[model samples]
Target: MSTIFRASRPAFRARTFFQQNASKTTRRFQSTESTTANAAPESWMQRFWKSEKGPKTVHFWAPMMKWGLVLVGVSDFARPAESLSLTQNAALTTTGIIWTRWCLIIKPKNYLLAAVNFFLGCVGVIQCSRIFMHHQAQKKLAEEVSEAKEAVKEAKDAIKHKSS
Candidate 1:
């Protein structure tokens, strides 16, 4: 069979394979070059617009969206410190610190993410400190009230002794 002769001749098959595919490969390689060559140089903004981490991709948008957390924390500024929860703030601070380090180590390095997380940590710490101070003040007031009551009781007993 001619098929057997063809199998025996690998050079003929290889030559035909290359000839058939060469046009397709060349077209792919050169498809966009000519149009781009006549274009003016791109500005930094333009370049960023089309870059891998641009607004079109999730990488940029995720960080932008994450700013909401910081805004929420900031909004709490009008709230009384006594209402703040230490556990919640501590969690935010811990998460912020851990991910801030992770952001720097990731491929391409997300500075926006790092900044947001870092600030998240800051907000958490400030809230925790406020709660701690409030608790401390309340505890001290409680101790003072206890001492005052004890002194009043002792003075009443002394009055009874004098009357007897």
Candidate 2:
């Protein structure tokens, strides 16, 4: 029993030492400097420049650069509708919608990112629509051409039968 108590005594001391140091570390995290109400009011531009998600960070610039995609998408409107790719537009639309929602839901809402993503979604949707329309017209035209070919063959067969 004496040996058992001696073995447990060291463990008990170690536990107490850990507890005391944990409390001290918690207290050590307390702020030493007090912020006074006498601080000068910052201008809107200054506030924007210093913001964590502002021009200094990728959150702002990345979205700014993304505007190029939107511009290109808009410009592509002039091209023949048949040139648009359905798969590429569909992928852009999916990613744009997902990223827009994510940027909005994040801790710091990135409105610029959301705007760019929203525009991308719009561009993708428009392009997809154009592509679908072009494909539909092509399908209808192909069917009509096949029908015309069959009609000509039947007419030729009728003429051949009459001659025979």
Candidate 3:
């Protein structure tokens, strides 16, 4: 039995990690096209967005991690102090479940800590996406602007030659 359990533990963890990573990769690839949908051809934004993998992973894993942290937060707040009976621990667990589900559902904002955490999680997702998009857009704009300047310089040189 011990051998069976020991052999299974690593397998289980590996399976879980792969499952999580697979989903994360799927989300990133799916979102990459949309992230630069507005980018112009040959623009730095297009090239930059085309090369990234971060946005997709965040798109996939942010929700899962938020929920995990919620559970952890609940556990920390509900754990009984020293000298507590087993019954107290059970009761606290039940209470924590109820509170967690409730905050997730009805009165979320009433629990300030949970609310803040939730908001931060959402903001983090949006910020990550926005930052990537912004960088892409900036790169595109810079490249376009530089190209335009070069074109203008060439046109001016052509005019000078014609006048000479």
Candidate 4:
């Protein structure tokens, strides 16, 4: 029994040591000064990428738009139509523009990409404007149709009343 107790004493000491250090580790993490001292300074690019606006444009929008443009290009190539090609180009340009803006805003600005994006965005803007106008016209036509239907219903009601 004494031999077994002596053998277990080492394990008991190790457990106590770990328990004491665990609280210190937790406290070290909770203290800002200690954490900063231990952590390496973040690079400007890293800091920029971590920023709220940066992540949204860079991680989310940039990738989504890029993939969308790629798919559009592939579909256009398969079809080989003028309109489809134009649409693909417009979308590509818009994505480039957004990417350029994101690059410019972040650390290490990429002027070349920004210039390319700006030119493409400008070209695509024309296509986008035309699409916007068409959508507006459709909305106006729908409103007119609804108004006409309402008028027709009112006229029918009046006619029925007069007949009665």
Query: Candidate 1, residue 73: CA error in Å?
Result: 1.0
In order, candidate lDDTs are 0.85, 0.89, 0.53, 0.64
lDDT-superior candidate, 2 or 4:
2
Q: What is the per-residue lDDT of model 1 for residues 20-60, given as tens digits with 9 covering 90 to 100?
A: 78866876755555877788999999999998789898879
Q: What tens digits encode model 3's per-residue C-alpha lDDT throughout 12-41? A: 445676778887787654654575677655
Return the lDDT, model 2, position 68.
94
Winner on TM-score between 1 and 3 is: 1
Cα misplacement distance, residue 154 of candidate 2 (Å): 1.5
Pairs in clash, predicted candidate 1: none
- Give one digit per residue, the lDDT tens place, for model 4 in 1-164: 99988976775446677778887788554655666778899999898788654654654455444454445444443442324435655666667677778878975565544655665565556555555566678799999999999999999999999999
Give each prediction's root-mean-square deviation over alpha carbons: 6.9, 6.3, 30.6, 15.1
**Candidate 3 error regions (>4 Å):** 1-119
Which stretch of 10 consecutive residues in model 2 shows the poorest summed lDDT? 29-38
Candidate scoring better on lDDT of 3 and 4: 4
Error of 2 at 20 (Å): 17
Q: Which residue ranges in model 2 land beyond 4 Å of their true spot?
A: 1-41
Best by lDDT: 2
| Model 2 score (lDDT) | 0.89
Where in model 1 is the C-alpha error above 4 Å?
A: 1-38
